[model samples]
Target: MLNLLQIEFHKMRYNRATKIFLIIYFCLFFSITLFSSIRFNLGEINFQLAEQGIFNFPYIWHFNTYFAAILKIFLALVVISMISTEYSNQTLKQNLIDGLSKKEFILSKFYMIIALSLASTILIFLVSLGLGLIFSDFNEINIIFSEMGYLGTYFLKLVAFFSFCLFLGVWIKRSAFVIGALFVWWVAEGIIKGILTFRKQKYGIKDQISQFFPLEAMNNLIKEPLTKLGIVKSSIGVVNDVNIYWYQILIALIWTFIFVWGAYFLIKKRDL
Candidate 1:
């Protein structure tokens, strides 16, 4: 596995698009962290968020994780571009022709996905720790660690999303079409959830059902802090309350498995 991952990394090391996207990805991610933390530290944000300790010790984990997760799409685009470029360049076929088995080839890509996801998670963790230590007024260590679950949730969500992206990349083999489908899927989920939310009271549709939607289920792993934004109800234009369900983690893992299994099936069954 290590040798396979090394080969994958070598491929990425020479890919200009992968490097460019990574640069853009980290820049946007850190910019968000800095801007949000600085504004809150300077008392420039809305009173509601300020009162909620948006950048404070314990809550800093949640705030940073959520914002950092926003950058996952950039990583997904990089993954898609990398995979699709291989198809375009016939590198995947060359590797197999050079004696790499089909399973190893696909597993190498999955290893890359896991590594990238972990790297992103670690970046978020470091930034959150730095920001919390610098500006947080709390001195208790327990408070700083209390909301750490969000970090894990953020990691799982990234893995799940990227797994789906991997499946898309292999199945479509076209970066543009795969990315477009991703956008449509995201928007479609929001639209479907919105419609279901609108008819919730009439049909007794529960909020939990929305979590079953692939993206929605991954996102639901981290419930929005009610006091931070206070816009969940306002934006949704519904009075429905969202609670953090622990099982959503399990649901996300299941979806991740299915998506990865789908990728494996497609890669193994299809001609390279």
Candidate 2:
């Protein structure tokens, strides 16, 4: 099992798609940090204002929330490609024929996803922390860590989202379709939810429907206090009373098990 995992890791390290994803991930983080640093240095942002307790903490919070949200999309792409590429290349079949158990194969892939998610989260957090230190001396580090309390919940949500994407990739066995469907689902669902909210005369039933989408639920899991931007009501009508941490952990686990188990069952029952 350990040897199989090593081989999997080696293949991932050499995969061109994985390399491109890492580059894109780093570029996104670097761009965010660069923009924030420039804004701070240009006198466009007043440090005293931040220190005066007017918008300091919320500013940091908003940055973190937006950063996480953007990174989530890239992470989803990485997950999809990781699973899809193996099947597309017929490498998964070769591995299976070489004495790798179905359980080991699936578990290895899932473990890699978890490791990647955690590593990306930590990388972003550290980069943001360094930027905060470089850009200001206003004790934003504490605020960053405070906001980081959502990392674990968000990690679980990523796992669930990745699991679903993996299942889709396996079921369809087409990279273009899997990637296209993910983006379409992400954009269309949000748009539909928005239209529903706009059409609602009083109630928020449309928003409730949107809340069930994996992306929305995942965002709710990493509920950062900073990005509320005065939007009071949650998509599910939970309002300020929502416990995103608990909700994310619960739903992510349930969905992760369901999708991964379903995929495993299908793999075992079907000929690859």
Worst 10 residues of 2 by lDDT: 49-58
lDDT of 2 by residue, 191-271 (tens): 987787887746744455656666776667765453253333344445453355455566667778888887788788888
Model 1 lDDT tens row, 1-272: 99999999999998898999999999998887667554333456443343345668777777677767878889999889878988999988999899998879878988998999999989988987887787777958888888688878888988899989998999999999999999999999999888888888779876557888889988887766544544554666555344566688889999999888898899899875
Runs of candidate 1 exceeding 4 Å displacement: 39-52, 226-243
lDDT of 2 at 125: 61
Best by TM-score: 1
Looking at model 1, the pairs that clash are none
Local error of candidate 2 at residue 187 (angstroms) = 4.1
